[model samples]
Structure formats: structure tokens, C-alpha cells
Target: MKKLVTLVLFLFILTSTNVVAFANSTPKIPVLLYHVVTQNPSGTYQFSLTDFKNDMAYLKKNGYTPLSLNQYYNILNGTVTAPSRPVLLTFDDSTSDFYTNVYPVLKQYNFKATQFAVTDWLDTNGHLTRAQLQMLSANGIDIANHTIKHQPLTSDWNTQYSAINNANIKLKSITNNAANSVAYPYGNYNSTTMSVLKNLGCQGGFTVSGGLSSSNSNKYELPRIIMANGDSVSVFARKLTTGY
Candidate 1:
């Protein structure tokens, strides 16, 4: 009886240790957000193409893997495991610079990214065209919703529904890919936002809130750190390591 009890205790300890190890091994992802990649410092949200390239190089050299929105969703849903030091690189606004500047750099790095497109603005003045979006989708870049007119979803329920639904429809019409994930415009949303998104078949949403993303994080309120203009390599490194 004594021997049996000792073996049972040993087995319990081993099981507990494995569970703790598995928990500790879970990846904490940092979703890095950018608006435009350009040479001109157009605004606080626009990053220079050089800086963006350096950031990507740093990520590659430091062993960071960029994951698409769909892969991140699967991670959250426990359908897949995250890669080593996974990060989600998200570009918002579907700016023309994405095709002219960002796409080439991403292709060079052999990396994937998610783009949150404001459907109504596409092919207008300096935004992406339907053809560009279709090519992007075909190239494995996940194009997500940023609403129809970049409207904040904290307004009335009907307005929110219209904006999101309209954008999703236009996105699918152009790219033949459903907008299953979204990034809230200006990172603004309300309590009703999650329910509405779920009703629309959205599996996840992103906010401008800065932090590390985890599998246990709220699916509709995931945090992202905005990459700003003139952020040095060290700052970018810190953002990746510490999620500032």
C-alpha cells in the first residue's frame, strides 16, 4: 500500500510539471499595426519605407515569424499552435503605398501580413484599387474589414451593422474572400461591437490598444501596438520584446 501511494504521488507531480511547462510555452504574440509605408512623413501614423524595411529585417534576424489574421484566429481557437516568436503585422487603410512600397518588402522577406481595408475608399485618390486587393488576396495576404467609410463602430447599432456589412460585402465582391476579421477604425468600438461582429461571422477583431496578444485574449478586443514614424530599431525591438 505504501509503495502504491508513493508511485501515485510521483505520477501526479510529473503530470503537474508537464502541464506547467505547456502553459509556459504558450506564445505571446505582438500584433504590430501600421497605416502607410512611405518616404514622406505624411502623418504620425505613416512610417517611412526605410524604417519599415529595417523593422522587417530586424524581425527576420531576430527570429520573429509573421502570421496572418487567419492563422492568429486559429491559434486563439486552439485549432493550431503558434510558431516560434510569432507576430501579426497589420496594415490599415489599404493605402496605395501598400502596393507600391509595402508589398515588395513583404515579398522580399517572404512574410505575410493582414490589411484592414476601408472598402468605400478603395481606388479613390490614394487608396488601393480592386485589382490590387484581388492580387493581394491571391498572394496570401489576408484582407480584413476596416468598415465601409472608416466609421467608428461605437455609434448606433444600425449604423455599425451597415458599415461592417457593407464593407464585408464589397471586400468579398472584390477579393472573393470574406472579411472574417476586422480592425476597428481609430480603434474605437463599444460593448455591442463584439456581438455585432459575431453576428456577422467575424471570428476576431483588433484594437489600437498596445499589448502582447495571447491565445487566452478576448477575441474581439485584441490589442495591437501601432508602429509610428521615426521609431528607431531599438524602439521597434522593444515593442516586439515588451509590447510597449
Candidate 2:
């Protein structure tokens, strides 16, 4: 009887240790956000070309793997395992500068990225054109939805649903790939926003919150770290390692 009790305690300890090990091995990835990448920095979200390139070089040299929005979700869904040093590089607004500036550098690094595009902004005022979107989609960049007009989804249900669904339709018409995920405009979203997104069959959502994304994170409020024009390579490195 004494030996049997000892064996039972040993088995319990072993089980607990295995559970702890599995929890510790879970990956915590960082999603970095960007807006405009250009030589001429103007807005708060505008990032300089040199810094942007440096950031990419740092990520590449440090063996960081950039994943698309879909791949990120795959990791969370348990169908796929996360890679070593996984990072989700997300560019918002899908400005013309992304075509003129960011796309070339991303190609040079051979990195995959997600572009959160405002459907209404496309083909107007400095945003990416339909041809540009198609080209990017064909390449490694995954175009996801921001909204129809970059509007915040704090409004009524009808407005939120239309803004998201219409943008999804528009993106499909251009790239033949509807959005798998979405980023809430200005990080504004309520329960209504989530309902609209779920009804549209969205897999996940992103927000402007700064934190590391874990497998257990909320599906509709995954976090992202915003990049600014003045963020240096060192700052970028710190944010990447510590997850803001």
C-alpha cells in the first residue's frame, strides 16, 4: 500500500510538470503596425523609408519570421504550430506609398505582411490603386480590411456592418481574396462591431493595443504595437523583444 501511494504521487508530479512545460512553450508573437512608409514623413503614423528598411533588416538579420494574418490565426486555432520568432508585420491604410515604398523593401527581404486597406480609400487621394492591390495580393502581401472609409465602428449596427461587409466585397472584386481579418479603425469597436464581424464570417480581429499576441488572446481584440515616424532601430528592437 505504501509503494502504491508513492507511485500515484510520482504520476501526479509528472503530469503537472508536463502541463507546465506545454504552457511555457506557447509562443507569444508581436504584431507590429505601420501606416505610411515614405521618404517624406508628415503624419503621426508616417514612417521614414530609411528607418523602415532598417527595421526590416533588423528583423531579417535576427531571424524573425513574418507571418500573414491568416497564418497568425492558424497558429491560434491549433491547426498549425507557431514558428520560431514569429512576427506579424501589418501595414494600415494601404496608401500609395506602400506600393511606391514598402512593397519593394518587403520583396527585397522576402517577407510576408498584411495590409489593412480602407476600401473607399483605394483609387482615391493617394491610396493604392486596384492594380496595385492585385499585384500586392499576388505577391506575399495579404490585404485585409480596415473599413469602407476608415471610419470608426462605434456607430450603429447598420453602419458598422455595411462599412465592413462592403469593404470585404470591394477587396474581393479587386484581389479575388476577401479579408480574413480586420483592424478596427482607431481601435474603436464595441459589442456591435464584434457582432457585425462575426456575422460576416471573420476569423479574427486586430486592435491598436500594444502587447504580445498569445494563442489564448481574444479573437476580436488581438493586440498590435503601433510604429511611429521617429522610432529608431533600437527602439524597434526593444519593442519586438519585450512586445511593447
Candidate 3:
């Protein structure tokens, strides 16, 4: 009986050690993608402000740390260590809803986020203006490239290159910060897209593909989970704990 008890204790210790090792080896970072935040959402991509606030509250209460895309890149490159339960919150499209609906909630939590902006859309009606983008950058928000016209990168090489370069230039002019990351327009890209981004010195690229990002993820094709309209608090919890 004494020997049996000793064997069980040894097995428990071994199992616990292996579990810890596995967890350390595989660090899953969930990058959440959001399009627009509004009280009355119009499409599947738009999320209500109420739901967005709830999601933020859950993340804050759950000890999840929000990291900007630049910080995420540093972590991936081993230049920085991540906090426990680190999450990357990314908002695509520089819509006015972000200025009106999202920034206030994020500010309340003192959290940081990345915003991908289309250069041509700025200063237009119902879109984020240059002044707003500059202010967002000053307040810990990273302004990234989302192409000039939000066109799919499956087009010709010149078209793809021009779109990315023009957007980067305009974004830098407005924010005085390098636009080093990109989120593919419509979550769409082709074989030439990555090469174009690389040549332009883009450090990170995001896709709409749903999964947990890791250090081993492709720099130009990093996956992100979409947070859409009507996602409850429970659904948000599951997306963080379990990859889509």
C-alpha cells in the first residue's frame, strides 16, 4: 500500500511538469479583429457599442492584457516579453464609428489598440479624419496600413505595390509614425501580396483567418479572429480561451 501511494505521487508530479512545459512551449495569442462599432449595427461585421463595452469589461476583469500590433511584433521577434494572457486588439478601417464609439470605451479601460486605415477614406464623411488619426496615435493607438482604396491585393503587382506604398506614405504624413503593419483588405491577398509588403518594409500583416497567433506564425499572413455583431459575452470568452 505504501509503494502504491508513492507511485501515484510520482505520476502526479510528472504529469504536472509535462503540462507546464507544454503550456510554456505553446503560447497562444489571440488577435481579435473588429470592423465598426455602432449602437445600431447595419451588417454582420458591425458590432453594437454595448457588446463592445461588455467585451472590454470581460477582458479587463479576466486579466487579459491588450497589446498594440507593434508590441505584438516585438514579442514575436523576441525583443520583448509578453504579459500574462496577452491579447492584440485590432480595428480595421478608419471609420468615424471608431472615433465615436470605440475610442471612448478603450480610453475608459486605458487599453491600447491598432487601427488600420485607408488613406483615401480619411477626411471623408463618416470616416476618421487626419486629425483624429493623429490624436489616436498620440494616445497609444497604432495606425496601420489598410491600402489606399481597400482593394484586394490579388490584382497586378504594380497595383498592389502602389496601394500599399501610397497608404503608408499618407499614414506617416498624418501620424508622423511609420505604418509598418497591414491588414489585408476584405481579408483577401494572393501570392504576390506578401512579397510586396516585405519589400516595402512592412513588419506585420494580418488576415481574417480565425485562429490563435503564435511566435511561429507567418509574419505576413498572421491569423486573426473576427469579433462580429451579436457576439455575446460567452462567445467572447470562448474565442479567447479557445481559438476559432
Candidate 4:
């Protein structure tokens, strides 16, 4: 991990884009937020499988390396280094479509990804089953937390804490590992949420806004670029490099 991070720092220095994002005090990572990848898509969160494939292929062709959440944690918390084109592919919601459509393509490219799951939804009708989550966990996909029941975490401390607390327990039970991070449901959170996460010893708390993340970023409020269905391959590429 140290070696990987060192190489990233070397690359980060060589290709530092001062024009993009906040000034480079630390290496910044583009964390992508994706929802369901589907053949027939709907909603602002839905992304077509074809476009998804194109996005993945573009990354491969252009030399982007995707990292799991743990790998990313090591990089950011340790050396603040990054591969020249490093990006974290994060999928919100463990839809069955991820197992059926997405995981295979990610493997084809030998890429790593993190899935933020709503613990209660696992084994439900449309969500990934516990067995499938286990499979994903064992297969290099980092299974993390979305929340207990996809509830809207607000200023209410108990509601926010319970949502995160309950889900971590369920995730640990199913995946054999407690979540190292959590993406607040619907990308909503507050200082109370951060306090709960800190008390729970969570490593990172992801949000929906903010363009990119770095060592200088708030560990409890990292941002991700939301990938919507209407976004084309060009838009996806721009989002990673330019963060607009």
C-alpha cells in the first residue's frame, strides 16, 4: 500500500492540474457516485449499462485505476498520494443489477469498486441477497454502509446514529466486516451525524456534493460526483478530470 501510494504521489506531482478543483495541498481523488446500472433505466440516478461499460472502458483506455475504499483510505490517510489518474468507483444501493450486470464488467477490467448498501434492504426483492453480498465482499468489492433502511439522516442525533449503527452491525454480520465508511442516505448529513460516526470509529463519511476529496478534506464529509443516466461518456470523463 505504501509503494502504491508513493507511485501515486510521484504521478500526482507530474500531472498536477492547478486549474482543476481546490489548490493542490494534497492529492485529490475523484470519488464517483453511481446508483443502479440497468438495461432499461429511469430516474436521475439510473445509468444505462451500455454507458456504464463505455465509462469503464474509457477509464481503462485512458489509464485510470479504480481503488476500493480500504485502498483509498490507506492512500489518503497515509501519504496523500494517488496514481496519475486514480479514481474511486462508488455505487450507492446494492441493487441486484449490480451483481447481475455491473460486477462482471468491473472484473473484466480488473477494477476495484465500493458498494454502499442499505443494510435492511439486503435480501429484499430487488436488492442483493446476503449470500451475494458475501460473494462480492470476498471477490475484491468493498462492501460499505449506506444506512440501516435508507432513512433520511437529519439533525436528530438518535435517528442518525441508529441508522448508521444498526447498518454497520448488519453489514458486519453479512459481509464478515464492519463498514470502514458510510455514505449518508440521499447524501444528507450534519455535525451530529459526523459526531455519531466519530464515536462509532467510522473512517469516512461520504456526502453527495463536493467535487473531489483529499487529505485536506473533512473525513466525515467527503464528496462524490453523482453520475446520472443522462450523462454521456464525455461528461463522465470531464467529471473525473475537471470535476464540473
Candidate 5:
């Protein structure tokens, strides 16, 4: 009887392990964050063009498909079929570097990506022009609001609320596409900020909290891993593996 009970316990352990493995076998999604896709400008947020290209190449070679935030939300919400290898490529700040450096590589792979732009900063020195944004939309890229002045949404109720609302209005007015997503400037946010975003009809928001997102996570305060200088191809590859 003792031997029979021990065998039964061993079988139970094996069955449990198989069950856990089966659950984990489901594909995990990754949402990668990027800012200032341009030449390294010393203290500024930037990614070297070579690294950007290599990362894109790695994604392509590894059979990764970049999805827009809306598509990703739909997958999480069970409204659409999720890709076998779903990954979100997001660029913030709408820099001219994106047009000059990043666009070609994205185009080469025919991968869709999300870009958040501060409406008030368009057409300034290093930022992207309105025409460039329109071109990006026409090329099938997803554009979202990054606030009008790039202020942290935690400042105050009125200003913070209006910043998000006004930016979305202007972004759509320019690109004729619904700007439904927001990225917290400097990854700053509070409870009130999240409330404002919900009232403004924002489908989702991004934070620089550094981790993988899931269906159980907050859609409005999603965390993302930043990609920047010193992140080599191997590091990038590892990030994809960890889903960060």
C-alpha cells in the first residue's frame, strides 16, 4: 500500500508539471519601447541607427510580427485573432530621426508600429514635421498622442486632462486617424491621471515601468522596457526572449 501511494504521488507530480508546461507553451507577447530613434546626442534619449536596423533584422529573422496597439488590445480583449508571435514596436517623441533612420527598416520588414507624438512639438528643429507624420500614417503606421506639450500628466487635473484631450484632437485633425493611445511623458502618472485618460476615451497608455504586459494587467497603465544606447544585438535578442 505504501509503494502504491508513492507511485500515485509521483504520477500526480508528473501530470502537474505537464499541465504547467502546456500552459506556458502559449506564445507570450512583447511590447518594446523606443525613444528618439536617431544618432546618439550625448545626453538625449537616442538609439544608434545601426542598432535599430540590427534589432529590426533580428525581429524579422526570428519571425516576429509587430502589431499596433489597437490590434494588441483587441488580442488581449479577445476581439481579434492574436498573432503567433505578437510584438509591439513603439517609438515616442516623433523625432525626424524616425523618418530618416527608422522608417526604412520598418518598411523593409513590412511591420506595423506605434508612434506617439507631441502635437505642439511638430515641425520644430529635431522633431518630425506635420507632413512627415501624415506620410507615416499613409504608410500604415499607427500614430497616438504623447500630449501637446509633453508635460507629465500628473501635474494637475485641468492641465493634465486637457493636455491629453487636446493632443488627441489635434493628432486626429492632422493625420485623420483616431489617436487612441497615450504614453506618459517621462513615464509619470498618478491615479488621477489614469482617471483622466479613461474619461478621455484612451484605449491604452504606456509607462516606463519595465516589464511584460498581460491580459490581467491594467490596460491604461501598461509598463514597457526601454531600448537605448549600450543595448547590443544580443541584449535585444535576450529582451525578446524574456518578453520585456
Candidate 6:
């Protein structure tokens, strides 16, 4: 009887401590990473316009706020206040489909998104044109750097640095605004690469790693969850709630 009583008391104290810790913890915001928005395309990297619209609608109805890339940076750096339900929607690659397919839906729902464009591929592979980039910025879409040639920073430092610099220059020419954020190509980066990025004025850089952002996370090197191509509406909803 005495042993049982001691065990129960210990368990109760542990449970109480856990509850206190959870109560004092801050909620983590989910950052959805998207690549291409297409018209019912069949691929792993493409989401239909309708599906995109549905996702936006879900956010709207759920009282979640869509954050721009800069806004996310502010949160990481402790410069801006975070909303109760905050989400950062990021589209990778500066594909023309983003302007034609994604932007319209975002505008329809009055939601903002961040686009990380490949400077070298802007005019190729149906990517966004220079004119469209300016228009996107004017319409409340943030333009970020995805590197000049979308090469891995850890593979070849010289080439990667040149590409990043070129992309920054091109993005500035298009939007006339300072671009300070980058998403690593192929989700590759090293300590040396991160050091170079820090020197280049990037407040934060994203990777393909999976996790939530917090005060302890490195602002220059952040992890992002992948949204596989052609994910169903149900799966997408689950992704939002579960932070996968």
C-alpha cells in the first residue's frame, strides 16, 4: 500500500508539471510551402487552381492570417508581432502559372503569398516575365530570391554565390525593393554557405527540412515542410492542422 501511494503521488506531480509546461508554451504557426499552381495538371509538384482556392477558403473561414515572406522574417527576428493564428504561404520558382493561376485566387480571397523566383529561369520554362514580377509586387505578392540558376549552395560555393547575387540584382531591377530572403536550391546548405548568406544581408534562408519555427531556431537557416504535388483537399486540410 505504501509503495502504491508513493508511485501515485509521483505520477500526479509529473502530470501537473507537464500541464504547466504546455499551458505556458507558445503555439507554432504552420508555413505551407508550394511550388507550382497549375490547371489540373498531373504531377507531384502541381496543385490545381481549384484546390488552391479551396485551401485559401479554408484559411479564410478558419480565421487564419496569411503572412508574406517579410512578415515571416519579422517574426523570426522578433521585429513584428505574431497573430494568434498565423500562416506563411510560400510558392517556389517564379513560374508564370503563379501569376495566371495562383495570383488570381490569392487576390480573390485577399490573401498574400511569397514567391521565390529563379532569376535565370524567369523568361524560360514558362516562368514569370519581368513585367509580371513588378505587377505581382504592386498587387501585394512578395518576390524573394531562389538563386540565379537554382543550384545547390553546398555543392559549388563560387557558382552558388554568383547565382544568388545575380538573382538579387534581377529581383531588385524588377520590384525596385530590397530582396533579403532566399530558399536554398535542392534544400542544400552548409555552414560555409550559411556564412556567405549571412554576409549577403539575408535575414533568413529556408531549407527542405521539416519543423516549426521558434525563437531558438536560426533565423538564417530555417526548415520548411514539403507539400507534395497534387495533394487532395482533405490531405491538404490535414496538413494545415497537423503541421506536416
* TM-scores of the candidates in the order shown: 0.89, 0.89, 0.89, 0.87, 0.86, 0.84
- State the lDDT at 73 in candidate 1: 74
Off-target runs (Cα >4 Å) in candidate 5 are 1-27, 39-41
At residue 39, give the lDDT of candidate 3: 89
RMSD of each: 5.3, 5.4, 9.2, 7.6, 8.4, 9.3
Q: What is the per-residue lDDT of model 3 for residues 35-138, given as tens digits with 9 covering 90 to 100?
A: 98998998899998999999999999999999987778766765567787989999998999999899999999999999999999999999999999999999
lDDT of candidate 5 over 132-208, digit per residue (tens): 99999989799998999999877778988889999999999889988998999999989888888889888888998
**What is the per-residue lDDT of model 6 for residues 190-231, given as tens digits with 9 covering 90 to 100?**
887787687788778888776677656687667776787667
Off by over 4 Å in 1: 1-24
Q: Of the pair 1 and 5, which is ahead by TM-score?
A: 1
The candidate that wins on lDDT is 3
Better of 2 and 5 by lDDT: 2
Q: What is the lDDT of candidate 3?
A: 0.90
Tell me the tens digit of each residue's lDDT in model 4 across 55-148: 9999999999899787687667644456667799999888999999999999999999999998888889999999999999999999998998
Please, what are the lDDT tens digits per residue for candidate 1 over residues 80-147?
A: 77787889999999999999999999999999999999998998999999999999999979999999
Clashing pairs in 6: 44-229
- Worst window of 10 by summed lDDT in candidate 3: 18-27
Tell me the deviation in Å of residue 27 in model 2: 0.6
The whole-model lDDT of each prediction reads: 0.89, 0.89, 0.90, 0.87, 0.84, 0.80
Segments of candidate 2 deviating more than 4 angstroms:
1-24
lDDT head-to-head 5 vs 6, winner: 5
**Error at 85, model 5, angstroms:** 1.3
Which window of 10 residues has the lowest lDDT sum in candidate 5? 19-28
Give the per-residue lDDT digits (tens) of candidate 2, residues 1-244: 9999999999999987865655466688899999989888987889999999999999999999999877788776654667879999999998899998999999999999999999888889898999999999999899999999999889999999899999999999998987868899999999999888889999888999899888678889999999998999999999997878
